[model samples]
Target: MIGLANGCSATWHANRIFFLTVAAYALAVVFAASHWDIPLNLRIYSRPFLLFGFGVTVILFVVIATRVMLERPARLFPTLGRRLRGYDVVNRLIVGVPVALTLPVFFSLFTSMKNGLSRIVPFYADTTIVALDRAIHGGQDAWRVLHPVLGAGPLTFALNFLYNVWFAVMFVVLFCVTFSTGDERLRSRYLVAFVLTCVLLGNAAATVFASVGPAFVMPFYGNDTFFPLMNYLQATNAVYPVWAVDTQRMLLAYAALDGPRPGSGISAFPSIHVAVAMLNAIYLWRFSSLLRWLSVAFLIAIELGSVHLAWHYAVDGYASMLATPVIWIFAGWLSGLRRWPVAATAVS
Candidate 1:
């Protein structure tokens, strides 16, 4: 611990705090890694994270060493030297959050890849898909009208991504971060929560529910509307298999031609898009009541788009959406336990 002129460094000797934090973080990383189950990708991301962490630690030590050398003892102890130490813990916390979140989901998924879990029914869950199919029975007509409009033009296709709602939500989150207190410790915590939740939703989507969207699988009409967008993504990830699969699904969807495409019998149930969007809505509410409403609206649009576009069954959207709000509430609760000192100071 460092000895300050008049008092203890408020953040010095914070090692114990981070030890607990890192332990919790390690557990989450394990969960994520097992869940994502992708080894190659995990390695690809970890290297940069490690490098960044190392660079930050080095800078922190340099600063602390300089402080210890120059800082004088209190007037009462003029003959004594001031010592600077234990500040590196802060740097560790700074980078630990994301590492904990991403690595675990990736590992957890990779771990489960063998049970044929990667292709399981949520990727392949049966009963859930059946329930989704049932909902499609009554809503098909209502959806047909909405679906065509969504796939009709670039404007509609852009709207299909729920850009308006998300764009609004992003600003709300940004503003909250901007105005948060001087302390970022807790803000970073919640930020990590959101990042992990979304990553989990995406990784799960990739592994469990790889549905070729309505635009691709349904033969209702020519998917020229959204196919172009899907095609662009395909071109974007021509290198990565994960991306390649997404693009192919879109092409398969374009080929399905809009009338009645075969939903990837293997994928469907639990719409990831809804899960993620709704989660964003839930977390954004951490900022303001206005954000809550925006999230709610986005939730609704994402749900509607899922079915109208036939990328997901109504049941799947409902299930995925449910988890989102639940996860958001949890994330908010945990974040609430701590406050951003910097954020609070700034706001004050």
Candidate 2:
């Protein structure tokens, strides 16, 4: 127990923002479980935790291997040997491994609890969100407008691929930011923003809004308003095989099960996918012009894909894009507080 406390303390000192975020997530889970009678399922998070662990381990190995390869042949093994013996490497492993492990657990709980609480509230904002979407798109679905230009076989496939790749992209960004011995300020900023976005925007805002998005509207609300959109997507899936369609179906089916399943959680007021993409883009803005532009393009693509794929309403993406910047700014301020001697002492 003392060793465990020490380990946790070290982790907190290394990444206070992440630890705090996880604590907040835990409290939220407890509150939800007590109030809503939501069961906490540790089993659901096991597979995803394993997958993320494996992926991050491979990525770290590749990065280290690439660095070793870049060295002169004469110095390669020596350099690798030195790095392996170095205090920095050992310290990073000691600190980073636990963080990497805990993040997925926190995320799983956040998602699961959010999904359970969403159902408990029993107030879905699908109609209101769709109305907002139509209002913004001049009384027409955004997909209808975008379908003509981007609904082609190749573009649809590409968009679906890109949309689905958001998870991988997010993981890469997260792994790099969390574990890489890069610029401390940049890393802290990104980490804080990410936590704030997931907890404050992704879960909290989603709970307040309580929406099921475009994809689950029919099943949840019996509203056929999005049937035309769904039918169009089914046709596209027939031709090009969009992954979002299948994922949406799977999530809906899981949601229909008896109780809170491990990976089953759904709410779609402000699209967390777009919000995270936008958050990353905002942070990447300071890196370089080319990266900034690429981030912006990716953000736009995600926004479009979120709508066109029928996973979200147009307004869902809009709200996410708008809210993300504010959350980023707030996170920045919170990160800045870490610089204070008092804050540093507290973490220590």
Candidate 3:
């Protein structure tokens, strides 16, 4: 019992330390970039909004840690013996390691590791959007022909806007499910496998497309809401008290990255937001009918939002839809180890 508690406590300490470090580095890079006016190897690191977001993130982290820390495993499951020892280690690791190690590495990879993008896109254009941009913005009549049915009006337009909410909803659900169900081995396994998939999908989409998104590529498409907020974030510096009321802050938190301009001229393809919501759907499909319908709704909104808002070229959505199933299958394959456990521990 004493050894398990010490091990779990150590893991928790390591994770909290890493999280604080990542938050600090991200803010330091953003602030240094903004004030010094020097090119920080990564483009996103220099913006004022990024700096502000980092500060806010630090505060939120502390609050969440304080709230959740009290319920730490040793307190929750008092009884322990050799039989339950293995699970105690695995459970603590799952809860602590993903928070401490995985998330920081995942975010760090994108902010610095530009080479990952280079490695994958060697066969394709440096960024996949060049040909795509021309095809849609070109004098092609096929886009116009296809536009009418996909365009947002009173009927599907509200549905179109809802995709924005779904992605956030999905992420919050995963965070809550994994963090709250700490004692159940089966539940924890599902949470780990699914959150890992969501995080991977997010990074992969960012690497594959390297897009700021249509909200930035060409903001006039009516969904200028996402673009303007991002534009505010990329060009600004310093967090203001009133800035908390600013819509752009929420937009940036939800969005993986922002573009150079407030609107028009950023990565605008493969709608990763859509991809994430879809991934959530795949995980929840078997468990909840509510999620299954939400997933279908999410995809439809994604298809319409991308085209109607002119945020993504039609091909981007099509590509995302095609790749989603493949990514889901791959993530599932990693989690196939559950039938036979490497080790299992029960709590009394």
Candidate 4:
């Protein structure tokens, strides 16, 4: 087992870069929020933070209690008492406390920056992305190619459901990693990669490649190139409750408002949905083969939904698929982590 000093040093190394990165990004978000006159409402943002924090804590407790009860029914309470005092639990506490601070601040700033995008930089990439999408899809939009098969009301609704499920899956993964007793090196890498993926691709590249996506093309650019797809979705909504259509309308409303609301933002190009899904897949690949394939399938579905739902161009998912691994590798390198020896007991 590693010594306390070694563990402490490793923890510092694991989190050092993340802390610095978040601090720097927080300042950047504040500057952007100021530019848009969006005040950071701790009340608005902390609600999700508390939910995730408490939700995950309760989940961990239940899982631990269940496992202990199953294995040693009479010793459940005693086992929990001992395990709660164990180093693994201690490690989770170390990570959890900081995450409690970071998560809410991160959410508030993320919403602010996202809501401020149009004010900061008008979307001018839709036309170019549209052309590139057609070229990539052999002279037709990606949705048109997929529509022949996935355009039915049931299929559209299913895809929308899977698309919306991305949020839950994202938070589940976040909490899992935050409280995980797995390999500390990998845990740290995943956390770092997660933040960078959102910041670099979600905010930075999004600003550079601002596009309103297929659904908003008419509203933002007065272009009808995607009108067919949008019309099909609207028609499908009459039967299937296409939530994305309503969500898009809500985001547009939020964008028009003076203050940032939760989940208020518009971005297309290098889909963050696809990017984070791929990141999860990459992180899970090492643990379980079944989980690996499941994540891959989920990633595929998310990419398809991004296009089929008119939420992203095909190339946006393509960029995310391509760039996520590169960012993961860069995060691993930046974390200064070496592969944990297979025989080594994970930080506990």
Task: List residue ranges in candidate 1 displaced over 4 A.
Answer: 1-40, 43-123, 126-133, 136-142, 148-151, 160-189, 192-268, 286-293, 332-348
Poorest stretch of ten by lDDT in candidate 2: 339-348
Candidate 1 lDDT over residue span 1-348, tens digit each: 223311122322211233344356446545644565422223433554356445655765576666655665344232222322133343444333433434433433333332222333333343345445656666333354454455444434444446334534543453343224345554444454544454455445445655444444423333353454455434434432222235345645533342212111223445655776765665566668986887788777777656654455566777776666666556556555444353232211
Q: What digit string (tens of lDDT, one per residue) describes model 2 on residues 224-338? A: 8889878877888888888888888888887766555654688787888899999889888988899899889999999888888888888888888899899888877776665
lDDT ranking from best candidate downward: 4, 2, 1, 3
- Write the residue-wise lDDT of candidate 4 on 1-348 in tens digits: 457655655455446667777888888887877776655654557877787777777877888777777787566677788867773677766655676567677767777777677777889998899899999999999999999999999999999999999999998888778766567668778888999999989988898998889988888878898898989999999988899999999988876777678888889987999999999999989878899999999999999999999999999999999999999999889776444352133343
Candidate 4 yields a Cα-based lDDT of 0.83
By TM-score, the better pick of 1 and 4 is 4
Which consecutive 10 residues in model 4 have the weakest lDDT in total? 339-348
Regions more than 4 Å wrong, model 4: 1-13, 33-43, 83-87, 337-348
TM-score of each: 0.47, 0.88, 0.49, 0.89
- The backbone clash count of each candidate, in order, is 48, 0, 5, 2
Highest lDDT against the true fold, candidate: 4
Candidate 3 Cα deviation (angstroms), residue 143: 6.1
lDDT of 4 at 47: 74
Using TM-score as the measure, the top candidate is 4
